[model samples]
Target: MTLVVFLLVPRLHLLDLAGPAQAFSTAADLGHGYELRYVAEHEEVPTAQGVPLRASVQWPALTADDLVIVPGWRGRFAAHARLSKATRAALVAHHASGGTVASVCAGAYALAQAGLLDGRRSTTHHALQDELAARYPATRVQRDVLYVVDDRVVTSAGIASGIDLALHLIAVRHGAADAAKVAREMVVYARRNGDEPQRSAMLRHRGHLSDTVHRAQDLIDARFADRLPLAEIAAACDVSPRTLTRLFSAATGMTPLRYQQTLRLERAENLIAHGSTVDAAARSTGFDDARMLRRLRSRLP
Candidate 1:
């Protein structure tokens, strides 16, 4: 089993800790061999949400397959001040030993303190990006991103971005399909990649209250790479094809097929950027041939 130790600090932002933890827990429930653990310098931990949490002060034996995550906390200066020297040393040693380390939101401060981020590209909560850069000049801070990964060191933007980071880790270890299953179980819209902006396409277009559109989107998101007939989708939603088309187009400013193609394009972009040739990316994302993928990509603005 891979051990995931969350380094707990005072005044923790609940989601920054819970989001990633929940993703991994769900992955474990889905048959991934992950063992989650919590560690803190003190037995009793206080959080900004006014909840007192308890953790083990004892550190566990770690292997290269293990991960140490520092969840973001409230009050940047005060929370960063509480990063104990021992905790910083542990982070450095773990990364030196080839174990992965990550941070969410202002938790990047903790990694910075450990000197793990020196000469690495990282990011944090948007509001804190400037300060994180100012204090850690050796670190290249990426702004307006969900997360950034430099080697085994990962850092994410504020709050819910932690979920994206965790999902990414799951994808890297297992497979994209496995991570998507966990995300579907958690009712996440879709998995966001590190390259995408903080507000990815799958998330940015979900603000509408149209239940029919939302339901269509959920189905489309789940199987975007598959062949989907509009009639089948409309029937599933108890609407005619024309009605589904009109409603979906009005709600999302794109037809259902267009939406699916958009998802395909996004995934294809990620795949190609990761060194997949056009033909391979096309086949992987369910394209009949490379021509369609090329045509779609050529239209990108």
Candidate 2:
């Protein structure tokens, strides 16, 4: 396989760079025909922590290939935006020509900026979930699974989720058993599909929302069982109820009530599945009524 990865300068995490690089290299060592190339916006790229990276090729030099990996950018995503216009255009063109595009963590931001994620499901670091959805309303940002493969595009959650995703791709291209051997060599257990929640249970902050609104969300999360109204939350943020509803919905896909319900139900499901009873799980997740919880769960399925 021939592959070229585009790393954002001044923000590429070492692991994101090394994970796929090592995966393909090991595949080659294991008798698979694989070639990997790492490119960047400039000839000499530097990480967010100032570790200099020697790019194999610059942006202008990159051309179409079998696969292109975009590593997460470093620093605050809003502060450190995605690729330059030319680079973004090139990526769009490359994907349009039938190439696979994969992103780890903040790398999804670049893909979203290029409009590649529109109407597709993707993921990133759980902490940036709200920001991602706010920026790309057309994109369905999933947080509960390790990675989601939407056609030719694949996206993983923050950090080590990249490893899981990389191994998955390797398994798909080569074989699961071969990928398992590689993962064992790397000291990571071979994980199967849907092995873990892709998204964190914690809510993310939207940069555009006020600090007060952010605090309000934290409060609601902490006390999900409390019947807090939108008016109460808005008052806490010194905003009108309508304003609060709009901002919260914009930050997250659902309204405040829906977001709270989703979180509560997620917690309830986790608690109910094992040794615990349904009532116990419901109570643990702040639902006083087990019937209500079961109704909600039934609706979801």
Candidate 3:
């Protein structure tokens, strides 16, 4: 099982910890091999919301598949927050061992303290962007983006954006379909990737209140890489093909086939990025030939 460890600091923001925690917990519920653990410099820590959080003072052993996250705290200046030297060393060692190290909002300061953000592309809450940049001259601090993933280090902008960061991680580890399932179960729209205009298929076709449309979408999401005809999708949703087409178009601005095509295209692009050839990616994503894949790629802005 992959372990997800949270480094809870004093006065940590409740949402910063809860948002990502919930995302991982939901993924676990969906049968992902995830185990959540909390560690802190002290056994008991107070949150910004006045809730007391209990954590293990001792750090846990982590593997390359494990993830360690630092949730933002309540201080006006992150530089003022005190992090134990042991914790800093642990963060550094974990990254060196191929583990992922992530920070949310002011939590980036802690990673910066551990020397993980040096010469890395990272971001924090907009209000603290200047301070994070000034303090860590070697780190490139981006502003206005939800989150950034540089090497094995991830940093998110603010408190709520932590959810986006976690969902992105889930997509990277699992797949877009699993990530979308978690997002749908959480009733939250998956945010677009910071570097991509095309959103995840899970979120791209969400936001409508039609049960029929949603049913069709669920089938499409689960079997996008299969050769599913519109008639089969319509039959599964208990609607005529013409009626399903109209409802889906009105709800998501795309036909059911188009929605499936988008999912297939996105999956193909990811496969290609990870060293798969055009023909292999096309076959893997349910395309009969690379011609359609190349045509779709040319249409991307």
lDDT of 1 by residue, 71-163 (tens): 999986444355678888899999999989999999999999889999999999989999989999999999878889887899999899999
Top lDDT hit: 3
The local distance difference test score of each candidate is 0.84, 0.70, 0.87
Give the lDDT of residue 161 in candidate 2.
Answer: 75
Q: Which is the leading candidate under TM-score?
A: 3
Candidate 1 overall lDDT versus native: 0.84
Evaluated at residue 201, the lDDT of candidate 3 is 61
Q: Tens digits of per-residue lDDT for model 3 on 122-205?
A: 999988999999989999987778888787899998898888789878876776778888888888863543463324666756
Model 2, 236-275: lDDT tens digits are 7788989888877776556778767776776666455334
Q: What RMSD does each model have against the real structure?
A: 4.1, 16.5, 2.9
What is the lDDT, from 0 to 100, of the residue 67 in candidate 3? 98
**What is the total number of backbone clashes in candidate 2?**
5
Write down the lDDT that model 3 would get: 0.87
